[model samples]
Target: MNPVRKRRFILVSALVVGAATVIGLVLLGLRENINMFYLPSQVNSGEAPRDRSIRAGGMVLEKSWQRDELVSTFVLTDRQGSEFTVRYEGILPDLFREGQGVIVEGAIGADGVLAAREVLAKHDENYMPPELADMHLERPK
Candidate 1:
């Protein structure tokens, strides 16, 4: 083969390998950072992946909230009545309360508890503050 052609082929092959390596690294990083959402039933039935970052959402079980210093523990119940325990070591959202909808991002431990990294409380669109409920306002036509 010609020397010039051989050098060009080598250069092209190297570029292709380099690009592939970069893409692989990017995908690996993303895989580690990506968090998946799951419901209580899915987690209870062994459908949710264990030891991976995930987001679990459900209603906060009544009388399940326990707070001690910085750590808070609670149980999340889905529509199907399946419940999962969650432990968070940070400040919870102000709106968080028993029976409220919440989504927690964290990893499911080997013991089947969610070790929450963050907690987000969800509210309905028609929700109104109790202090403002007494004052009714007319809707725009």
Candidate 2:
């Protein structure tokens, strides 16, 4: 093979290999970023994956939101509106409210309950007023 042609070929091969390696690493790293969504019923039925981090979304069951100053309790629902009681120990999102949508991430316990370590609440752009977000607004009247 011509010397220049051989060098070019080696360069192209190295680039391809490097690109593949980067792609593989990116996908592996994405594992931490990826979250699966499920419902309370699915978790109770053992359908939700256990041990693997997952997100369970549902409406906060009316009157289900309870707390002992440390562990906050609430409920999640499915499409059919079926509800499940959820107890968690952590500071809830500002958007977390009754009848609001919420996602809990954690593992499912053998007792047919979802034991989560992290909780993420969803809200719309209207959720927080500009003043509230900027911390310059007065109390809602």
Top candidate on TM-score is 1
TM-score of each: 0.65, 0.57
- How high is the CA lDDT of each candidate model? 0.87, 0.76
- lDDT for predicted candidate 2 compared with the true structure: 0.76
Write one digit per residue (lDDT tens) for candidate 2, span 62-131: 6777789878877787647466667788888887888788888877666645676888887755666676
Off by over 4 Å in 2: 1-35, 79-81, 124-141
Residue 10's lDDT within candidate 1 is: 99
The regions of model 1 sitting more than 4 angstroms off are 1-36, 129-141
Q: Among all windows of ten consecutive residues in candidate 2, which has the lowest summed lDDT?
A: 132-141
Error of 1 at 95 (Å): 0.8
**Candidate with best lDDT:** 1
